[model samples]
Target: MLYVFLSICCSVIVSILLKLARRYSIDISQAITWNYSMAILLTWLFFKPQFQNLQAAPIGIYTAVGLLLPLVFWIMASSVRVAGIVRTDVAQRLSLFIPLLASFLVFGEALTPLKIAGIIVGFAAILCSIPWQKKTANRKVISNAWMYLVVVFFGFGAIDILFKKVAAFREIPYTTSLFFIYSLAFIIALTGLLIRVFNRKARIVWPHIMFGLILGVANFGNILFYLRAHKALASNPSAVFSAMNIGVITVGTLVGVFVFNERLSLVNKIGIGLAIVAIILITLSQH
Candidate 1:
């Protein structure tokens, strides 16, 4: 439980730092690339090379997760740009319904009435939170941010399912799985950066790089702690971690409103309320 709490805390802080970076003229792509590099290094430093005996199945699963690195960063950055941090986060978190349903279908995890109700409410919240305006007098006027939200939803959902599957495999060490997954992501990202460099469009923004380093360490903290927590509490670790959405939403909302000066419409407010209730119900159902 402590590990889970620490992971949630670190994730929240990372979000705040990422938002702050926008104010410093940081290049989002460079920042994300640097973040992944730092994450790879930090994960290695902590986990070391004790994962030499991990089975093939877990390695394959983590490799599939690594394939999502590029899409994940792109969609997350686009969502933040188009929908603002609060709404983007709401969309991202509420998308957990995808994995929940996937677990039921793939792993034969039974979904109780309470779980079904919570999932429905959560989906409704996400729908309400989406902004549909004819015209907006803002610089980041993205016509297809909703599409980016969908991408984030499915991308993260698949990643969660993969991680859960890897965790279920008894032969794989959790730390080893994470290290390989991240290392694969870093390799892919580095390749992309090199390609950009060859095109002479790879601008190195130092502030963004530093911010990415900070975010990388923070994100590593999140994954490390959560993996440890899942290992310690094998039964229904998803439910326990899912409950932390309340904390993420709370912190994201506060930061979005005060720091970013973002505003929510009435529908968005109602959506946030529904999400909160749904998260509470889901957590209670696990107990």
Candidate 2:
């Protein structure tokens, strides 16, 4: 239970940090680049993933996740920037639908009634969650936001599937795989940063580094405690997954509305309500 709480808190804090970064004009790309330095250090210290273990791990999967990670972070940053925390969080939570859809199509997994209902409701949640308005300019803002949200939806889902594939290799330690993923992602980001510096498009800043370090710690804690929750509830993975997603959406909505004063119309509220229901249904269907 503590693990669950910590995991949810850490996840929400990452979003909160990103929200604040925008307000303070933090360069998210640079922050994200430095974020991996902290994350890798933490992973190495705690997980102690050995160098010898890497030879057996799948390099292709690591590369894929590595590339996808930085790309998705940029998309998510865009999501939080343009869409607000509430919509971004809900869009991410509802991304569970992507893997389920892939499972049915690619893996030939059978869909039960609960799953069908969950899928329908999940799409509803997406449609309703967008910060849509009646005015043309506002609608255009939301319309562009939907594009970012959709990329977030599928981008994260693909990343999720890639991680699962790495996990399926029983011989490969999860920590070792994560270290490689972050390492490769760091390389990619560093390269991009150097290019930007050469073109005079970006420059280093102390505040962004500070924010990145904080975000990295929060990001590491998010995964660490979530894994701990799985260990605590070994008999029920579904519970861990369901609780984490629902908790983020539920609490994220509160913070966005109350603390940040991000507006959510009536339909958006209803959509969030259905998202909770959809998560439960999806979890039940798994069992």
Candidate 3:
């Protein structure tokens, strides 16, 4: 339970850090690039996952995911910046539908009646939650932000599938696989950073580097505490899964609305209500 709480707090903190970054007009790509280096160091120092027992098959999956991590992360930061944390967080959590859909398609899992209903309602909720600004307002800004949320939803779901694959691969420990993933991610992000520098689109900013260090700590802490929660609640992993999602949604929504004054329409609020119901139905369907 302690671990669960810590994980939830850490997850919310990462979002908060991103919010702060945007508030300060910091270049998120640079921060995210530096984030990988910090994450790798923390993974090595604490997790100490063995790299000797590496397997080629799992490495391929991790490398592929590593490539997507930074790209999706940048999109997520953009989502939070434009769409606000509440909508972004809800879309991210509801991404479970993708893996559920993939399971039905790939593994021939039974799509129970409730699961089908949940998928339908879950998607409706996502559509509703998007901030559809009036034409009188900034239409392009609103539309672009909403699209970012859509990308984040599917992007995270794909990453979740890779995580499932990593978990299933018993030949290599997941921690070691994560180390490799982080290493790959670091290389990828560094390359992106260098490209930006060469193109003169961005400059080496000291403040951005400092912000990245903070983001890196929070980002890695979120993962570290989440893994710890699973270890502590191995008997009932669903508890961690449910609590983590709900907690983040609840906390993120509050922080977005209260702290940042992010506005949401009545329909958007209803979408959040339905999203919770849909999440429970899907989780229950698994059993």
Estimate the TM-score for candidate 1: 0.88
- Clash-forming residue pairs, model 2: none
Report the C-alpha displacement of residue 146, candidate 2, in angstroms: 1.3
Pairwise lDDT winner, candidates 2 and 3 = 2
* Candidate 1 lDDT tens digits, 21-131: 667777676777788888878878988746555545455677788878755876787677667778877876776778788878987988898988998898889887776
Give TM-scores for every candidate, taking all chains together and pairing residue i with residue i. 0.88, 0.95, 0.94
User: Candidate 3's residue-wise lDDT over 179-262, tens digit each?
Assistant: 889889989999988998999999988899988888888888888888889989998887888788888888889999999888
Candidate 2 global CA lDDT score: 0.89
Point out where model 3 deviates above 4 Å.
Answer: 55-57, 135-141
- When sorted by TM-score, best at the front, the candidate numbers are 2, 3, 1
Among the numbered candidates, top lDDT falls to 2
Q: Pick out the ten consecutive residues of candidate 3 with the lowest summed lDDT.
A: 134-143
The prediction achieving the highest TM-score against the true structure is 2
**Candidate 2: residue 165 Cα off by (Å):** 0.7
Please list the Cα RMSD from the true structure of every candidate, rounded to 1 decimal place.
2.7, 1.9, 1.9
The collision pairs in model 3 are none
